[model samples]
Target: MANDTNEFWGKQAEPFRAFFDMQGEAMREMFGQMTPQGLSGAIPSATMAPGDMAEWAKVAGELQRMWLEFVQERAQKDMAGANPMDPAQWMLMTQSLAKQVPMAPLESAQKMAGDAMQMWQSVFTRFMAGGDPEDKPDLPRKDRRFADPAWQDHPAFALLHQTYLMLAEYFTKAARDVEGIAPDKRKQLEFATTMLVEAMSPDNFLLTNPVVMKRTIETKGQNLVRGMQHLINDLRRGQLTHTDSDAFTLGENLAATPGKVVHETPLYQLVQYSPSTEEVYETPLVIFPPWINRFYILDLTPKKSFIKWAVDQGITVFVVSWKSADASMKDVVWDDYIRSQIEAIDHVRDRLNVPSVHTIGYCVAGTTLAATLAVLARRDEADKVKSATFFTAQVDFEKSGELKTFIDDGQLEMIGKLSSEGYLDGRYLAATFNALRGKDLIWNYVVNNYLLGEDYPAFDLLHWNGDVTNLPAKWHRDYLRDLYRDNKLVVPDALSADGTPIDLTRIETPAYIQAGKEDHIAPAASVWRATRHFKGPVTFLLAGSGHIAGVVNPPAANKYQYWTGDSSAASLKEYVEGADEHPGSWWPHWLDWLESHGAKKVPAKGKRKPGGKGDKVIEDAPGRYVKTR
Candidate 1:
């Protein structure tokens, strides 16, 4: 707090060599804490020589001098609560440097004149001696954008792709090298630049991309004509099509696990799944999935359905199907969502005649569940929830990854404007998330459906991803302001749900927190930090893949693995070192931890079922609410 300026610029800036050492350590920490080593694949493949570092430092200093005004202007906006800087500007500035100047030099003074000339000569001599520009140079790891065989085999295509990468590298390096700015702001600038660079890739266009062009040539332009049709269809729907929508029937194939919607509310519908075993756990399991989207991610299919799996394991499972907010739900605040959870908890207790139930909260729902637990504890009803499990839920926002880019002053204001009609449209939230992974979620579809004119196959995950939902403006506003931006959720009683002060430390329920090793939305670092907030015995698990793939992982697939670590490790590094890697889904491990929480089994023959209670059955599993949008 004391040093607004890590100020690695100006006269007081740390010595250039020392500053880079500090930067290196910070970069290591960021990636080391957020993901496993193999996942940090975006780093430049080529390493810098000692002399190159000095030249790079000089270039950086020159860049800082040029961009200092822009940073200052942004700082002013930040202080005034203005939108500050737009990402497009970041892209334009970097693009200009790469185009306007060949990144020539800082040759005004005699400083590095000999070195600069030698550098230029070396570059020219090296290229002239090289056999072919078509021969691929060392490039960034994990960049599958140029994976097509033609990109590697065809001379012209290879040259074109390599040139694009050079320009991209130049622009990104320039944008990321800006100094005289705070670290958080630097990250936003760097990320925005990278996004634009990724967007402008040669592969995204029909003409420049070899594969798309090849297909168009072979199809005699019919590919482009079909692509136009897809464009028209997407325009009508107001978004890109990620899957063959017709292939998935919600209640039939997608959310197909048999169950009954026993309880319904304006905000959510509680679906109590029929048990698959003769005996079930006395304590039921309740899932509060993210309202920002549908709950069916956990109940996708018989093979991948977590709900069905639990049911088969002699555990009765109930999941909340949240209502997509409309104009009528405009006045709903954060507490209303909290009350809905409390209501669902009580309803489950009353219907099943159980003292407590195990609960699982995925993504945003998990954050609110923590607050719900605090509310329950403060209200002297903490016994209602037997145990808690969080799937990629971030309570501490300090290391909340790229999602924060959308929380800037201007973006938040834009959200406010969009939500004037009570809540922000589902499309807006969906678009924001799509932009985060624009290369895949946005542009990949753009090239496939609009350029290559390919029809997307039926994919359950993409189908689920496309079914976006509304975000309550008031609740969402408070969420962005108080939680994401303000960092108040970690403080004791700093937040409240309808006047009941919520505190995380007050809740004593045992917790099993699962985080994706590669989760970007709810970063591993951010998720791991929450373990310290709970006073109970918290068991933290790290799963392979990302937020969606990791949580939806099915053991039978025998795919990616997971890791178990000590919750109280001193740091993320220590925590990871202490981790014991396991070769399967974390679902079985979670079930074991849940059962050990003292939930007794009772005969399913005479179980006090949800439908027979006063609440009664509303409809079938994955009820009418999920199908609303």
Candidate 2:
């Protein structure tokens, strides 16, 4: 037992120790070349003779030479112990590396430059002839691409757009060829370079953007003054204003669903929504929304509220509204999350007099719920959960899209340092997420709030996005390291909450897994992989649009689309190939599936009354925790 404990801790601490050791080695090497006298001479002395200036300059030169030599030595060290290569072999290796670039095989910079010049000449000639010069280029349609029509029509804007695309492609290609760096580090470099280029995009700048310039002219420079005011306000507050906060009030407009918090804990508040239908499902449904954002996302507005839709579908719903973590909750870990969820589930089960409850987890919450269920299953308590539903959530992290780039050892170490105060600041996590969709999330706001001087639309979705929540340091660290970095959840005995091994296959409860077709955070493929780990019947649904839009889609809007398939297929590819496309939202389909399952109809209890022991009303619906910054 002692050896096993020592081994576990040693494995956990190995990476950190190696990181510090490398840093220490570098520092020692750096200082070793500097003599005491030379080091002291480099600094400007309080009293010095005129001759000391030349001496100082000479010392500086020597220091510079030493730095260059050190860098060269480090570079050589990275390639040490490798097989020697002839000129031909070296050329072949270089060629092999270049092939990794997506565009390298297609065209060279010189060729692309020539193409750009020809296109520019044609555009200029057309403009001179008083014709529409902005013909849309045959570029691949991408959500991240600039969508302004003027970018194609105006020669100047067109040129700028072309330049941006070319540079982005070049940088991505170069990033792919960055040798001697770790794979994750290379990905981080690629992501950083892409973000930098996106930040410098012409569409984000007042002077370069045609729309902003036209708006400025129309507003008679008043827009600029307003923009300055916005900037000053944001600077003073140390936050980037994302939405017009005055647009929506919490209970009045946003989380207007009729409900009451029946139970409260230090971790979360459980709100039971009043049933709208005369008869409701005998088996109650409880939702666990990701704590990264407020739970109100599920109850955004009546028109788009999932809670309302579920209640109207005759399903009694309970949502977990999590409290934002602070220093006081620093000791909280995954075990705490699991314990709170189990407690909430037990309370709901006892109150409703139901043997089991249906569970729904969204995003990160889905991951947590899966872990919780696994822990329960290990203890022969799996029957507490009647069924499981996941919304755009992934258990497997192998192909977890762009978010994986930020989970490397270096970034995780830095996050560890930042969260040493017991909590990972919510702002940092929010900013990182925003950076993933920089053009739409970050620069769009910059152009609107700082350039056009426009208050963003009071969109409920954006409002929910802006309502960020902090995470306990221990809990978040466990999440990133176990799930994202090491993928421990999928590996047997690799994960646990209360010292009991978790195995996803033990979760035999029927599952309904939903994935967004264009979800950049949790890729559809990654989410689909979760279906394989569960032993019971699984229904995989693919929704149109990205993460937020895909999950928030309501049937009343008659917008977007979804695909349904035989979840028992051998692989995700097989399922997707055989899936039948369905029109409109997947909510109705999901309800139908739930009805077909074990969700029997029972008389609606109308407004919920507190019943469980110690279950007293904390406050009205959309509890105080939702209002936390």
Candidate 1 per-residue C-alpha lDDT over 1-629 given as tens digits, one digit per residue, 9 for 90 to 100: 01222221122221223423443454343223322222122222257466644443443343333335444754675632211123343333333222211111222233334433444454444345557755534423225788877775565565556555654555556556665556666666566556756766767765467797688546644565567567656644556789998988988888998888988889999898877787888889899999999999987867998888888889888899999998898889889989999999999898778888899999999999999998999999999998999999988899899888767666566678767788877876777788788888888887888778898889988899889898788889989989998888899988899789988999899999999989989989899998889888899999999999999888898889998877889776788898999887888998889889976788875334545436457787779999997
Compose the digit string of candidate 2's lDDT tens values, residues 1-629. 12422242233233224433443443343234344354444244666565664554454455555455655764776532211111232232223222222221222546656765765675566556653434533443223445766665677776666655655565556556655656765665566556645655667665466787788556544565567567655544445678787999999899988888888888899998877777888988999999888988888889999998888887889999999999889999988888888898899998788889999999999998998889889999989998899999989888888887666555566567667679887867777787788778877887888778897677888888877788998888778888998888999778788777889998888899999998998899999999879888898999999888999998999989999888888887898899999989999999888877775688775334333345457778888888876
Which residue pairs show collisions in model 2?
134-152, 134-153
Error of 2 at 261 (Å): 0.8
Candidate 1 all-Cα RMSD: 13.8
Top of the candidates by TM-score: 1
Q: Which stretches of candidate 1 lie over 4 Å from their true place?
A: 1-143, 606-615
Candidate lDDT scores, in order, read: 0.73, 0.74
- Model 1 vs. true fold: TM: 0.79
